[model samples]
Target: MGWTDGYIAVDWGTTNRRAYLIDGAGHCIDEFEDGMGILSVPDGGFPNAVSEIRQRLGDRPLLLAGMIGSNRGWHEAPYVPCPADIDDLVKGLVRAGDHEAIVPGVSFIGDGRADVMRGEEVQLLGAAAAGLLEPEALVCHPGTHNKWALLRQGRIHDFRTVMTGELFSLLKGHSILADLLQGEVEPNDTFKEAVRHSIAQQALPADLFAVRARVLLGQARKEDAASWTSGLLIGCDVHIGLARSSDPQVHVMGRPELTRLYATAIKEAGREAIELDGEQCFLAGIHEIARRIDG
Candidate 1:
């Protein structure tokens, strides 16, 4: 006999929780989302959120990833040692609540150093299945905390985190520029001009006096200032990320629009970029987690 049933895959992050009803073949049937991130949960909120998801889907096997498996989450699943292959991940599975099905984050400890990932880790594995991984490759995942990782021989070697989004938000909301450009004016040539200016320098100068003064002196459009600000920041980020090597295989994973913009910039700098579907990658992570756990 064959099994015919639905399973739930949940990617619960810090500010949001999303659940999908998937079949045995990893096809999504129904989906639901709520603002139930670990950060928003108020003591024992995990159980409540899990119950809500269960009620919506009825009785089904459940798998999860993201901060929900962190120490600050409902339950902390210890890290699965890395460079963990399939066997390691399978051995680390843990339930979400009661007999409710759930898989935990895998941890890797090597070289006297330790690292951890929740959901995205599994997603990366799925993307790599696209056959982009080789003996040497770089994967960049952009978001609030942009993650750049190095993979070799089918194993994640190391990674770095950048606070680009958070830094940009803080500057725009709390800096002097906030007062100067509160209401919508219009972003004109100033933004593109900023991109050109930043890209030209090869390295951004510490002094940003010119960025504002140019606008104040009527040299640049006031409305375009924000866009220019955005370009400069993003450009610098690209420059820094590509600083180490000229590897031809650069896989970018993130929001489509932003990734497209980054890809454009990268191409202009004579580099080709392969984009990974963010949503699919998220779902793929759950599937990969389940596979690893089952294996």
Candidate 2:
């Protein structure tokens, strides 16, 4: 199929950026990725960056999501409050440079705290449109900052953010736990065991020291510490998400490896989990937005 008639959809985050050239039929024709995230862009350079990308991919209509729409991004797009649907998101789109637009993030204020998310809203919209999301569904988008969202009647009811991934990184790189971890950790029996432990105990700070003690006492290998730590954090995230949700089943969106880990943890908690491809959901959401804009 001729892909030259496609528009560009970009998922521009803090550390990296991904762009998809999608055809009129909503199929991705070409894709590109780069390390030039919002944080990397120099002041007043976003327009030039867009021009450079356009030169590589042609001057198609560009729609951006994620941190690229934040106050630190090319242009700040104010957040659309929660209980927002596809239509609300579509209406909230903010125009940028010529032929460019930024999707607004979603915000929730409740329980004496406020939460916000950007790129995941597109994924949620795609999931809802594809019939993958049920009424009153609990959707988990696992990443650096894991997002647990509640969807009611095709609208995002509320959500919570867990910095599990970020915390894991800090522990593995900066904390005393770093000394015990060796190499990349895979999701294995040790990981599962840690998940079960976290779920059962429901106390992370109290258990973290046990990891170090286990390694020092030769009860657990240093090589297994990373996986163990990963499991504990993920398990805690899932446990908290489930406890806050009234729904029994969860819809998880992420890469296969990450989602598998989350699914394993959810299953260990005796809850149901359905995995959805993150990229696909984002593309579908972009297509949906494009359609609504065109109409």
Candidate 3:
């Protein structure tokens, strides 16, 4: 069947994949998620994976996004350079087969830096399409490799990636503070205070060491170090993301758990934080792609 009437959309990533079925009416009828990401697919197993997805979801055509289009994934989809919109993404789609195609990622090169992203583009553009974001907005998509993007007139103008989450992991599991940075990072006073200190001090390794100093001085608890570190990392991230933009609000798009922490940091930085549902944004972006294909 032609994808114009109906299709399956897969927000396929590295370690996990989420799939949705859109009916002929353009409504998402059902969805499912699993650990069958690109990395899980054995070499040359993408075709089989596609077959299984079709069997499970429907016989409709497929529109895939995320790392599934990366070099190590099924097929390396081209990168649509900024500024790009949903239509640009559609135009850059790479066909792995007649029945299915992969959505391309976005690339930004400027200011003595180059940034690239795979899966977050769909949600970023989708947030605009879904009416959850302003025409001109600063979007923060939190993850192991967090993304900060500037949306200009519903297109991705430019973006940057901060490995805050990765840094947290490295510091927690391998660094000298490994034993202290344990437990889930929560949005509490300690965290917000650390965020404030981080912004005020603008000192890194210096501010980071405060966790130990506070503990040694009996001013903080071991269980709270994770929160403080999380705050510091996210605080620095928000500071960088908001440095040039005059926007007073930040759109935090991701899982609620991560978004909550980012929202706290954003507020501590004196900016309004608005949370956007990642799944809805992903579906909206996929639908926008479908609209272009059908047009």
Best-matching candidate per lDDT: 3
Each model's C-alpha lDDT?
A: 0.66, 0.88, 0.90
Give the TM-score of each candidate.
Answer: 0.82, 0.95, 0.95
Instruction: Please give, for residues 1-295, the per-residue lDDT of candidate 2 as tens digits.
Output: 1223568899999999999888888888888999999889999999888887778777799989999999999889999998899899889999996578899999999889899998999999888887777767899999999999999888999999999989888887889888876567677899899999999899999788889999888898888888898899999999889977767788999788789889888988889889999998898888888888777
List the candidate 1 regions with Cα displacement exceeding 4 Å. 1-4, 80-87, 98-117, 130-135, 179-210
Clashes of each: 9, 0, 0
- Candidate 3's C-alpha runs over 4 A off are none
lDDT of 3 by residue, 123-205 (tens): 99988988899889999999989999999998999999999988998999898889898787889998999889888888977
lDDT against true structure, model 1: 0.66
Any residue pairs clashing in model 1, and if so which? Answer: 66-119, 79-107, 80-107, 82-108, 186-223, 187-223, 187-224, 188-224, 191-228
* After superposition, candidate 2 runs with Cα above 4 Å error: 1-5
Between 1 and 3, whose lDDT is larger? 3
Report residue 169 deviation for candidate 2 (angstroms).
Answer: 0.8
Who is ahead in TM-score, 1 or 2? 2
